[model samples]
Target: MVRYLAGFPTPFASPANAIPANYAPNYQYLANPSEAGSLIWTLNMELTPIYAIAPEGPYANLIYDRLINALAGQLLQRPIPENFAGGINGDAYQQARTTFSNNFVSRVSIPGYLTGKTVTLFSGQVVPVITPQLRGLYAWHTEILVENAIATAPEEDIARLTDALTGFLDRIFFDLRNFGTSSADRALNYAATNAFQTASVLRQATGQGMQLDTIDVDRSPFCRMDSDCWDVRITFFDPENNRRARRVYRFTIDVSDAMPVTVGDVRSWPIS
Candidate 1:
């Protein structure tokens, strides 16, 4: 079995010298299926490749199809270069870039298991290989994530909620970034994506003038026999009177199997 890992699904031109000397500047060429074989897929964090992806098993083709779809989507959103060989005009190109820029574009999330094998690229860099799990694969944009919960919030409240949610996500992606090898890290990584419950709790907390205080993961005492579990606790407190009012929400995650799952309902309590 491979180690579990999560990161951005980034596509790259494999070899440093893969680009042809006379390659045309046309973007349409990228959408051609024939060109797909030359691209290398990788799971990246902070724009650094952590693992090179090599899809295996029955889902390989499906994974490839999804990746190609992401590429096609990005290309469709990109503005054509002004002097490109393609006959696309200036107005259409500008409009495409403007729309893409104004909106919060979604990025593909590839979370799965590593094959415990290493592969060397043409550039002599070696990276562990990962086979993505189709179950957790998704495309997400941060604002789109919490928009439904805060739909009717006042304009000022909406901004605060978005900040709280994104701050939680950014802290995980940057501050607590890890390989997802340990039971705790896996639970935390999974929590970062499946955060709708957290958002809901945050809405309730913020209404009472609470702010996110801390996030912690530890061994779960409530685990079933023969199962490995961890409890992820998200705490909130009143900024004005930090010592007097606080709340803690906890959810248990079982990671004994290849895919981790929530054990039961999210439990919460007060901490004064």
Candidate 2:
């Protein structure tokens, strides 16, 4: 998910007066500064839930049953007197034999059966029962938070925030470049150039491309250690392909050194 915060624009004086006699101003500016253009964007996101399972039972009993079954087939040895008989020789064995015989007699002999004339008949039947239980192991919830700062005029706070976001984007692009291509610096350049071309083509397709006349970059005033700035101009072809219309976009980015760089050319041009 992604969210965007439209920030206030920055206003400044025109540098047209600084142009030399042979140079021309790229865009006209008011003698007095006004609010910069508005930043517009839309935010979108989604939420999803995660689920897990758990089990419940008497773990100790289960372990004991498993252990007994596993060792049941093992052999055991005990010493006995050499002349000992198989059964009924010792008092302990006799007692044990008597107890077993009594248990068997109790199961087979019914009381009051001596009354021969009357007999009772019994039918055996068994009923089965089943029970099941379910438990929830874990539950999950997702949330999305979005914030926006809309300014009627250019503000320092907006610039700071935008600068921070641009830095983040630069790192992301750098890493993407490294993974997708091979060189990070080249990747950054490719992305920048592509952005310019895409904007140019989109505007041209919409009839606004003709309004663009030229594009350039200004490396001065951009902090080398913290920020990157670029000046882009979009130019429109004239009817005679001589005269042109143009617009400029000044972009600044902040990034870190840990980002990966991409390699190779990323330009895609239409075949004419």
Candidate 3:
């Protein structure tokens, strides 16, 4: 199951129209507060699952299933992109939309039944019967809100916002790397103990250092999941030599359960 975590704005509340004039644009000069200010905009995502199949036997099936589940859990528990700019209205927003569009088109184009196929019944009669196929894609969407805070400068405010957003994306990438390494290591260790001679080859083939190429998450109101969850898809790539390798795998993670909380240094106190 895919899980998405939405971002939260600071100060808990926001101004109706614009920020206050006294608000400093620089992070260094901004007052330290714990409560949110004003409501800004929200960010959301979409998630889909990717499956890999091994070329061997029943063991291959087992490994494949385990890997898929591992990836799902890893993505759900990891941090996702929190930057609102990188989301809907951000520079990379259009690209994400296009990617999702293509995904849907591809899924819909798949043939449900082969027209020219014939089948033989148990009664020894041959008939042209429609063979239903289940070749389809799985996808989901989520949304998150970000409270807008007044700042001294627009540029400075955007920069700070993006920084916070990138933090979530970075966390996801970090967790993915860790997950891949652990999975590969476990597979290698098992092979070493069970297969002995082939362990070295397997270990070398599935080692780390593989780079993830693309990560695309849908960024539209249509892709939202209520006030706080969204869907996302992340693509992974492998390196063959000094150059880039062919596209290897793709995974989608749906984040929902996690709630957004502002990060700052102000504590709430009661009037004495």
Candidate 4:
């Protein structure tokens, strides 16, 4: 992740448009409240995909190109060139963009899919208002994981239970995600958990509402250490208006069919 630091007129000055099929966060100021300078805004251009994409797809370069162009726009923004009239800032931005563009055009690894770091790009501005440097070109090691829940009952019975529970959760999050008001007893997933008196983010989401994407069984690869665990993720969202508000309901159930059953806790993972 590139940490860009700039003092803008308003937080809204930075463009909010982004690359497609990727996750983009809102322009936010520095984490420290006291250290937040005037109109400090950050633009996190994430290149990773929400779903899998082949390396050389037809639309692969579309987002990458747009991102480079956006960076060029930022580079050409005022305070930068004014401070670096000697020409170092322009040269560095062009070089980084060139390297990124070359890798992109050659069908090499897309820079967007790589892991990002939370760096302080402009530690202390000196001659130039802001100093931007490209870092990290490490090979990515993505883990493919999927876990299946243990079924003590017959296949038909398990399917019915999963379906019923899925519907119950869909309705539950409708209220929780929207109003931020839910009791432990009212939630089916939370009730299933051994020790959730419902004091969790699971019951604390603030948004209009979220749609239920999928509640089916997951069969992805699993961690050997957690072989006894059953995994289910509930994906939901208000796609058009709040893509960043996409959420997931994740839970690990201990295979009850085994000698000792272990059912884990309930939680929510915000994909946005």
The lDDT leader among the candidates is: 1
Whole-model lDDT, candidate 1? 0.67
Q: Cα deviation in Å at residue 198, candidate 1?
A: 1.2
Per residue, candidate 3 scores C-alpha lDDT tens digits across 1-272 of 11111111122132233322222112211232211112111111122111112113334333333323222322221111232235455444344344333222111111123246454444454544332222221222111111122122255344444333233234342432221112222222221122222222212223433333443333223423453222232233346554544333212222221212111221211111
lDDT of 2 by residue, 102-214 (tens): 22110000001011222121222221111111211111110000012113213544444333333333433343322112222323443343333333243332343232233
Instruction: List, residue by residue over 1-272, the lDDT tens digit for candidate 1.
Output: 01011122222333332222222112343345444445667666666777887777787767766665554443332333442222255454445444544332355567777789987766787889888877667655555666765676788788877878788888787788888878899889888877676677677778788888889999998789999999999899888985766899899999887678889998889987
Per-residue accuracy of model 4 over 1-272 as CA lDDT, tens digit each: 22333122222232332212211222332332222232222332133212121222454344333333343333322222222223445554345334433222211111223123232335442121221212211111111000022133355444443443344433443443221011211122322332222213222322234445554334324634655444555566775666366777665543322122324555676776
lDDT of 3: 0.27
lDDT of 3 at 111: 13
- Output the TM-score of candidate 3: 0.17
lDDT: the better of candidates 3 and 4? 4
User: Could you arrange the candidates by TM-score from highest to lowest?
Assistant: 1, 4, 2, 3
Lowest-sum lDDT 10-residue window in model 1: 1-10
Q: Who wins the TM-score comparison?
A: 1
> Positional deviation of 19 in candidate 2, in angstroms?
65
Cα deviation at 92, candidate 4, in Å, is 82
lDDT of 1 at 42: 69
Residue 174 lDDT in candidate 2: 45
Task: List ranges where model 3 is wrong by over 4 Å.
Answer: 1-208, 218-231, 240-272
